[model samples]
Target: MFTGLIETIGTIENYDDSKDGVVITITDCSPILEDVHLGDSISTNGVCLTVIEFDEQRTKFKVGVAPETLRKTNLGNLTTTSNVNLERAVTSDVRLGGHVVQGHVDTIATIVDKKPDGEAISYTFELRDKEFINYIVHKGFIAIDGTSLTITSVDDSKAQFSIMLISYSQSKVILAQKKIGDTVNIEVDLTGKLIEKQIESNLRQQMNNEESQLNKLISSIVERKVKELMK
Candidate 1:
């Protein structure tokens, strides 16, 4: 799990594609690779990827992504010079500064607009996938491109929030690279998703049972009226 607090921004040195899958090599300022092994997992642009290789001197790590992951995320559009968000997995000793982020991006969203709202900046993003909006709530926590944020306002298809970004966050987090028309990977709060699904399932089941009872009552009423008319 991740706290949605971005630790560093990684530069995509190279992206190689083959019939099997895509391999991405990224360089980060975080000494994340110092102890990183070949099988370690890293959050890249909000998507969890396994480290296939790394070099100590370059502070670089390589990860292989399947076609499905590339299709679901903006990784497919990444090139050699693309900037990607980077965050290492949470350890037991670290404080949970932000909300829980699984680094499993549900889908990608596009930036609609951004403007200066005093010192903090308020940005709006258009929800591309219809199902993604169901889990979003006003004042809820969300991770956009690996930066955890609280949703100040949210609608059926849009989310807006003003982020109080510090100098370190602005420089190291992916928020600095945002543009008006850029696409970003989105991951909703895993806890919220589970709770919403449970509520929906219960509501649907209750509605179905109520409908059955209503139909039976209506049928009984009609039968009684027919008997009365016959008499």
Candidate 2:
């Protein structure tokens, strides 16, 4: 698991695609690669990739991207010289500066707009799949390109949400350098999705005995959860 905190930005040195799968070599990551191992997992652009090979100097590392990951994330769009957000798995002793992130990409979103907001910059992203908008809430946590950020607002009409990056964060992560039409991998709050799944399962089990009561119960639970998140 990860805390969704980006440690550094690593440039894609090489992107080799073959009939077997995709292997990417990332350079300029000597800091985090110091204690790395062969099987260690690194959060690359918010998608967990296992370290398959590394050089003795530790300046660069290689990881293989699965087909499923390529289909679900923006990693497939990356090429040589692309910069990606990088974070190592959190240790038990470290403080979780960001929310829990599984390094699992839920979906990819496009940067629809970006504008200056005081010393900070605000970005608005439109989800490629509208169905996932249900997981997005105002003030809720969302990890974009492995950087944890709070949702400033949500627009159901456009299937979009906004986030603000302080000046300090802008210098630290790769998201600030992206263009308006560029796509970024997104991972929503895990807690919210878990809660929704549990409630949904419970409602489904009670559907046979009391359909009307189950519907009311599900509605009440959803409404209460929404209120709690908004607060």
Candidate 3:
């Protein structure tokens, strides 16, 4: 699991899409790659990717993106020079600076609006998969492009949500550099999803139990009516 706090911004050195598959090489990651190993997981643009290879200098690393992951995230939109938010998996000793981020992007969202809010900047994104909007809420936590942020407002009708980034965050993550039409990987709050699932399961079980009890009552009534008719 991750905390969604970006450690550094890594630049895409190479984006190779060969017949074998897509392999991305990210450079300028020395800040987070100091203790990197072959199997270490990195949150790149809000997607958990394993380190397939790394340079001896610890400045660059490569990861292979699966086909399904490409479809579900905005990673496919990255080019040779794209910048991505980078974060290492959290350890037990580290504080939970941000909410728990699994680096499992549910879908992609398009930047619909951008405006200056004093020293901060506000961005509004329209979700591509509108169904996921149910998971977003006002003042809820969200991970956009691997950077944890709080939702300032939500518009269900437009399938959009807004977030404000302070000047400090603007310099740390790639979101501030993106254009209005650019897309970013989105991971809604995990706790909300879990709660919704649990509620649905409980309601379903309750309905089943009620149906069984009703069936037993009907059977009992039929038996009593048949006995009276025979008498």
Candidate 4:
């Protein structure tokens, strides 16, 4: 699990595609990689990638991206020198700065608008998967390119939402590298997902109970009718 707080921005060094998947190498820009071990999970552009190799002295690490992951996220389009948001998996000791993020990209969203909002910048993104809009709410948390942000507004009819980025965040992360029409990997709040599942389960149980009660009532009425006929 992750907190969606971006630690640093890493530059893509190489991306090698093979029959199995794509092997990505990124230049480590944050100290988080200092204690990283093999098999450590890293969030790159909001996609959880396992560390296959690391070069501490050179400040680099490699991750293998499967074809399915490539198809689901914008990671496949990355090239050398491309900057991406990076975050290490949260430890049990650290404070949860951001909302729970799975580093699982739900869908790719396109930036439809970018404008200044007072001292901050606001970005409007349109999602291709309209069904996912149900998971997004105004003022809810969402992760874009691994950076957790609160939704300022949501347009369900257009399948678009806006997020406000303060000047500090804009300077810290790689959002400055993006512009209108660019695609970004998106991860909705994990808590919302869990709540949705729980609600669905409860609804299913209630429906089952209602069905059982109706069946029992029907059986009781049939028994009374049969008794009357016998008398």
Candidate 5:
């Protein structure tokens, strides 16, 4: 689990393909040798990756990306110098900033438009594949490329949102590197997913209860008719 608070803008230093998977090296602006170790989970571009090795002193870290993760995230397209949002897994005592992020990519959304809205920047991204859009809700929270943002508007296949880029968000994350046509990974809020599940579960329970009641009523009527016929 993660807090969605980006620690720094990490750049891809190197990537090598091997038979099993790809080994990735990343460099970031965070404090040197900040105690990150092997097996630590890092949120890279809204996707979770495990650290296979680290050279914190040299400001370098490495992760082994499985092919399955590559298929679900934009990490596969990474090359040397690709900047990404970086965040480590939260500790027990850290403040719960942002929202709960599983670092799981739901689907890919394309940026159709970007413009300024008041003091913030409004981005319009088209939601392709109805299955992905079904999870989107207006004013709800979403994490795109590991940066948590709120939805401002919604259409059949498009979503619009204005995000205020405070100084911290601008400096700590990779917003400086964002371009119009670039594709980023997306992760929906865990709260929204759970609420969706609850709704479905409640509806199924109600239907089952109604069916049981209907069956009992029919049995009662049958017994009453049998008594009347015997009389």
Candidate 6:
């Protein structure tokens, strides 16, 4: 798992598209690659990718993205010069700076508005997959391009939400590079998803139990009526 805190930004060096999938080579990601191995996982633009290869100098690494992942995220639109948020998987020893981020992007969202909010910047995004809004709540945690942010406001009907980024976050991550209409990978809070699943499961089980009891009651009543008629 990952914490939505971005470590640094990495520049895309090359994008190789094949029948299998796309292979992305990024350079200048030394910070994340400091203790990296061949199988280490890295969050690239909020997508969890395994390290397929890395340079001896630890300046660059290559990750292969499957077609399904490309379709779900904005990674397919990345170019050679595109800068992406980079984060290494959190270790058991480090403090959880940000909320739990699995790096499993659910959908892509489009930036509808960007404005200055005092020293911070506020961005409003419209989700492409509106169904995911069910799990998003105002003041809840959301990961945009792997940066964990709290939702300032949410328009549930319209499937849009706004988030404010402090000056430090804007300067440290690649959010500054984004503009209106640009798409970003989105990962809603994991806790919310788990809660929703549990609630749904409980509701289904309760409904089934109620239905079974009603059936039993009807059968007992019908049997009594038959006995009275026979008598």
lDDT of each: 0.79, 0.93, 0.93, 0.89, 0.75, 0.93
| lDDT of residue 72 for candidate 2 | 95
lDDT per residue, candidate 4, 99-218, as tens digits?
A: 889999999999999999889999999997878898999999999999989999999999999999998898878886789999999998877889999989986776678566656687
What would the per-residue lDDT of candidate 2 be over residues 1-231, giving only the tens digit for each residue?
A: 999889889999999998677999999999899999999999999999999999999999999998888989999899899999999998889789899999999999999999999999999999998988899999999999999999999999899999999999999999889989999999989988899999998877787565578777878999999999999
Q: How well does model 5 score by local distance difference test? A: 0.75
Candidate 5 lDDT by residue in tens digits, 40-111: 898888888888887736487888888888877777889999888888888899797788888888866666
Residue-level lDDT tens digits of model 1 in 84-200: 887789888978888898888888888777776655667777766867777777778888887888887776734433334544466767766688888888888787778888988
Candidate 1 global CA lDDT score: 0.79
The TM-score between candidate 5 and the true structure equals 0.82
Runs of candidate 4 with Cα error greater than 4 angstroms are: 28-30, 56-58, 211-231
Model 5 ranges with Cα > 4 A deviation: 29-33, 56-58, 157-168, 208-231
RMSD of 2: 7.2
Clashes of each: 0, 0, 0, 0, 0, 0
lDDT per residue (tens digit) for residues 30-68 in model 6: 988889999899999999999999999999999999999
Ten-residue stretch with the least lDDT total in model 4: 206-215
Residue 2, model 6, lDDT:
94
How many clashing residue pairs are found in candidate 6? Answer: 0
Cα lDDT, model 4, residue 213: 63
What's the TM-score of every candidate structure? 0.83, 0.90, 0.90, 0.89, 0.82, 0.91
TM-score of 3: 0.90
